[model samples]
Target: MASLAAGASFAIQLFARVGATGTTLLRVGFASLLLIAFWRPWRVRWTGRQLLGVALFGLTLGGMNLTFYLSLRTIPLGVAIAIELLGPLAVAVTFSRRVHDFAWIAMAVAGIALLLPLGGFARTLDPVGLGWALAAGALWAGYIVVGQKVARGHPGPALGLGLLVGALIALPFGVAVAGANLLTPAMLGAGLALAVLSSAVPYSLEMYALRRLPPQTFGVLLSLEPVMGALSGWLFLHQRLAPIQWLAIGCVVIASCGVAAGAAGRAPEPVVGPEPP
Candidate 1:
């Protein structure tokens, strides 16, 4: 929910003379710096395996932000988020044995089909944007997988290190695109806000939630993200969706909700880590 609000603000920031890459760099960079200061990752002794997991987690985190932001350049925020959600949806359903699980997956597929430019009604969406959203989805899946491995203990330090690695990965491209424009007061302020809203606060909340709730219940709550994104985009950015698009989003959301509910009785897993921004 917070990410949705932050993403709406980020869309506005993108129009403030900063490119998408630059915006991503600012977000990850500020998040890294702030977290590093607070968490003091240097104090933690890292094992070789832990270091590798953090690195992989960072790679997926960077890729997810980069591609999702790039997609926003050409697609509406709600639509992009709905498309990108396939990653987590896939993760949720991957190990399921229940017959109803496949039904949820089918419904999600149907929703995606409606979003595609396969018919005249859906032809307005940009193909390149769709591709970028799909790429983000793939990277999101990677983020969840690697995050589970790296989030075992000391989530704050692990996240701080991961953000640093992500910032390093994204910074060069941001510099190349936005150049000195990113250093302006307006951009810096907006970027800082983005980092706090999209990264710090949400990450902390998710980590806390994971510790207290079953993963399935948490997943069910997280399923509301697309709906929140849609509402936020509508209210903040005036990015209204068509009726069909709304229906499509509903299908995906329902599928996610169903999957989460089905798994709600399962035993809770140990805390892994916070999800990527």
Candidate 2:
């Protein structure tokens, strides 16, 4: 929920003349600095494979954030999130053996089909924006895979270092596009708030939750993210969706819930830390 609210704030930043790359850099960079200060990742000795895992994790994280923001530039927040959700859905289903799981997958497919702007709806969406959302979704799958690999080590230090790698990847592009505009006092303040809201606070809370909650419980909670995102977009950015779109969102949400419920019997997959805003 915190991440959802913070995600909505990106729309505000977008309208504030900061490019998507600039905002992504600020969010990841500031969060990295805070995490490094608190966790001091440098103290952790690393094997080559662990280092490589962190780098791949960071790349996926960076790509997810960058493409998500890019999609937000042209698509409504709820719609973009709904589309991007297919990545994690795909990940969940891949490990499932139950025949019923295909029903959930079908529901999600139906939802996506509704949003695809085909036939009479063809004029409703921007193709480039949809493409970016799909790209973000693919990166999100990569995030899950790489995140699992990185989680075998220290969570705090690994995350901090991974975030640093993401920051480094995004910084040059941010600087080029936003230039001195990114350095303005107003933008700086907003960026800091965004970082704390989207990354720091959420990461801390999620870590705490992971220690206490069952994976199934956590997955169930995580499934609400897109709904929260839509609500936040409506409340904060005034971005409203049509009735059919809302139904599509509901289908996706149902699919997520079904997957989470079915996965309860098995050992839980490693939880991905704070999601990209």
Candidate 3:
């Protein structure tokens, strides 16, 4: 989570030079290169179904991230991500068997109400930016579902190759938005670090945690992501929060904690994604 927070903060700062789309493109592009090099995933054969699924996985992953950074141009980074997490949180409880999980749903609903207005979203908010965030969130949820499917069917090396495909799709946009400026060494170095923080560190750390933690506990811990994002923004970016926004963050956190606790002790269920770009 700390890694993810750093990745996002770095993204905001990096975008000042690269532009948001360019930055996302570079990060994912570099990440794919690393995975392909390490896993050498092209050696294996793939079926039509696997290819299609992986293609969709990459598209969703790239699309979600592009939209997210775009949304951050107008919204606060923490707020954008907190809203985005509704995607995964909804996925977690919506597919579960437990009736007790609705508590989490209720908590989520309350949080949304606070962030969105009782009066009017259109009148009070940036509808366009929020709409972009929603698109990213939905894509994020789809990526989780599709990604797990890919991981289950192909497993280890497939994950690496699938990420490469995702990277490929985003490259043109990166070049278009950021242009030849992206090739400069300074941006490349920082972009590489962002990719590592966003991808490698969290990937390894979460895998380790999964061995020791139950799904419910994992869910609860995952809920801390927004808090972590906000903290990193505050500490590094000096992005302050309003009392209302903090309350909304709190409600969502509680709701997610409830969901995690409800699903505790269960064996690992894959809610796979592109290491959370």
Q: Which sections of candidate 1 miss by over 4 Å?
A: 112-118, 208-223, 271-277
Q: What lDDT score is found at residue 1 in candidate 2?
A: 66
Name the better of 1 and 3 by TM-score. Answer: 1
| Predicted model with the maximum lDDT | 1
Better of 1 and 3 by lDDT: 1
Q: How accurate locally is residue 181 in candidate 1, as Cα lDDT from 0 to 100?
A: 93
Best-fitting candidate, scored by TM-score: 1
| Model 3 lDDT-worst window of ten | 268-277
Candidate 1 residue pairs in clash (backbone atoms < 3 Å): 151-272
Q: What are the per-residue Cα lDDT tens digits for candidate 3 across 28-52?
A: 8777777667766676687888888
- Candidate 3: which stretches are off by over 4 Å? 43-45, 115-124, 203-222, 268-277
Compute the lDDT for candidate 1: 0.75
Where model 2 places Cα greater than 4 Å from the true spot, the runs are 115-121, 203-223, 269-277
What's the lDDT for all of these models? 0.75, 0.72, 0.71
lDDT ranking from best candidate downward = 1, 2, 3
lDDT of 3 at 238: 86
